[model samples]
Target: AEVAPGAVHVPDWLDLETRRRLVAACREWATPRAGFRAARLPNGGVMSVRTVCLGWHWYPYKYSKTIDDVDGAPVTPFPGWLAELGQRAVSDAYGAAVEYQPDIALINHYDSAAKMGLHQDKDEASLEPVVSLSLGDACVFRFGNTEHRGRPWTDVELRSGDLFVFGGPSRLAFHGVTKTLPDHGDPDLDLSGRLNITLRVSGF
Candidate 1:
């Protein structure tokens, strides 16, 4: 469904096997090197959600080749298959093949107590559609306008295996996850928390 002019939400986008593979991939990415860690803001506040970045390490307001906040480890390389996945996701959301090179993928984990604040993904130079894939627990996703983080926003319930893509007019829109439903993850997945993967192009 088109939630906004350029935002589309597709529920049950991933099947059981695909979700399992994705969960396994996430687990591997969270293990070594610049593994999953909380991002610290310039305001001396650490984000609630822990994140593991690929292709390019993302900091407070910019992208980097290394995890500057961490031990300065070189960030993991972005997988070509993942970029292809993003392309497929964008294409599926728009109901047409879209050219997109998501150079960076942000994998965020939100536990029962975790929640994201209203924010805009304006750090990237590219204005390509942002592809978001959800797994595990369900959450309330608020997609706002590009103007500000205030009202006039639409809230959508995002469940496991869901896909949401925003671009064009809504590429820079403010969005966030208000809260997550605990004990809602598929028991067979062996995952106890929610996972959100957002694909963005660096245009670099």
Candidate 2:
């Protein structure tokens, strides 16, 4: 469904086996070397969700190769398979195939109490389409306009295996997850929270 201009949501995009494999890979990425950690904002506030990154370590408002806020370890490399998946997603959503070499993967874990504020992803230098994949539980995804983070927003229920892509005019639109529904995850996945994996081009 086209949520807005340049924004599309594809439901049940990932199959059962693909989701299982991605989940397993996520677990490995959440290891001690480059594990999930809460993001501390410049305002001395900590974000509700815990996140792990690949290819580039995302700070409050910048991208880097090392996690200075955490153990300062190098982030895991972005996998080629993920880039291919992202390319397929863009093609599926926009009905065209583009050269999408996503260099960053931000994996966020949202528990039942975790909620992300409405914000625009403008830290990256590239304006390539943002490819997001949902796993585990369902959530209310708030997609707002590019003007501001105020009203005139649409809330969509993003379930496990759903895919959302935003680019072009909507690339800088404000979007966030309001609330995650616990116990609504697929029992086959055996995950307690919602996992959101977003692929982006760092333009580094």
Candidate 3:
């Protein structure tokens, strides 16, 4: 349970072996379920996209559709392990037995060419913190303030097996990835890109 004190970095939460396994699993998941579209900007321009979500696609940062997995329900609901992890993260951050059960784990994939602009994760019904895990290549994460998306920001290096948690006043903070640092993962992981799994309680 490592809290990102103003976007602090937690090295090796998953360790090398676990990180490798997670990367492989993510690649396997991204194969068939590709075609993650670029988000349309407000000016009618489309932002380049390499992200693929396991659940519904939030196009233009809005929930577009509900995906079914053979059955007619959502494909990737919250996993028990992930929810437990979220609880632990919250507890570790505040030193309290806070309950955080995240139902949506947005799996965002980023290639060398992919980068995210400043945005806030306010789509969830719960104001609880967001537990984000990084796998694959390392990237520079830019975290901004809650009111405005301008400067007075922190540049955090999100490497494989790193965890970032933001809540409270920082819950509505603006954040995005500036760039992915080149060749910053285990060679055996075959990480030509990066994957970010941010767990949240969408439905409250």
Candidate 4:
């Protein structure tokens, strides 16, 4: 479904097996070396959603090669296969051929109480499409306008295996997860929270 101009939401894009594999990969990436950690905002408040990054460490308003806020360790390398998956997602959604070589993956873990605020992903140098994959639980995704984070927004229920791609005019739109449903994940997954993997072109 086209949620907005240049923004597409493809439901159930990943099959059961694929979701399982991706979840396993997420577990590996969530290790202590480059694991999940709460992000502290510039206001001295911490974000509810815990995040971990690959290829580039994302601060509140910037991207870096190391996590200076944490232990200052280098982030895990972005996998080539994941980048390929992102390209395939863009092709499937937009029905066009383009070189979507994503260099960064921002993985966010949202528990039942975790929620993200409406914000624009403008930290990246590239205006390329942002490919997001959802897993484990369902959530209310709010896609707001580009002018501001106020009204005139649409709420969409994003379930496991769903893919959302935003670019072009919607690239700078304010979007966020309102709330996550508990115990709504596939029983086979055995995950207690929702996992969101967003692929981006850092252009660094």
RMSD of each: 1.0, 0.8, 3.6, 0.8
Q: What is the C-alpha lDDT of each candidate?
A: 0.90, 0.93, 0.69, 0.93
If ranked by TM-score, best first, what sequence of candidates would result?
A: 2, 4, 1, 3
lDDT of 4 by residue, 1-204 (tens): 998999999999988898998899999999887889999999999999999899999989999999888888888999999999999999999988878999999999999999999999989999999999999989999999999999999999999999999989999999999999987886768577999999999988
Q: List the candidate 2 regions with Cα displacement exceeding 4 Å.
A: none
lDDT of 3 by residue, 1-204 (tens): 322353434566666776776676566655554434455666887665455555454555455345421223344443466578768766665667987777666777777878888988766667867778888888998988877889878787888877777877778889999998768865667677788888776663
* Candidate 4: residue pairs that collide: none
lDDT of 3 at 144: 83
How many residue pairs collide in each prediction?
0, 0, 0, 0
**Per-residue error at 181 for model 4, in Å?**
0.9
How does residue 19 of candidate 1 score in lDDT? 91
* lDDT, candidate 1, at 181: 92
lDDT of 2 by residue, 49-165 (tens): 999999999999999898888877887989999999999999999998788899999999999999999999999999999999999999999999889889999999999999999
Question: Tens-digit lDDT track for model 1 on 42-125?
Answer: 999999999999999999999999889888988888998888889999998888987888899999999998999999998998
**Model 3 regions more than 4 Å off:** 1-8, 31-37, 64-74
RMSD over all Cα atoms, model 4:
0.8
Clashing pairs in 2: none
What is the TM-score of each predicted model, taking all chains together? 0.97, 0.98, 0.81, 0.98
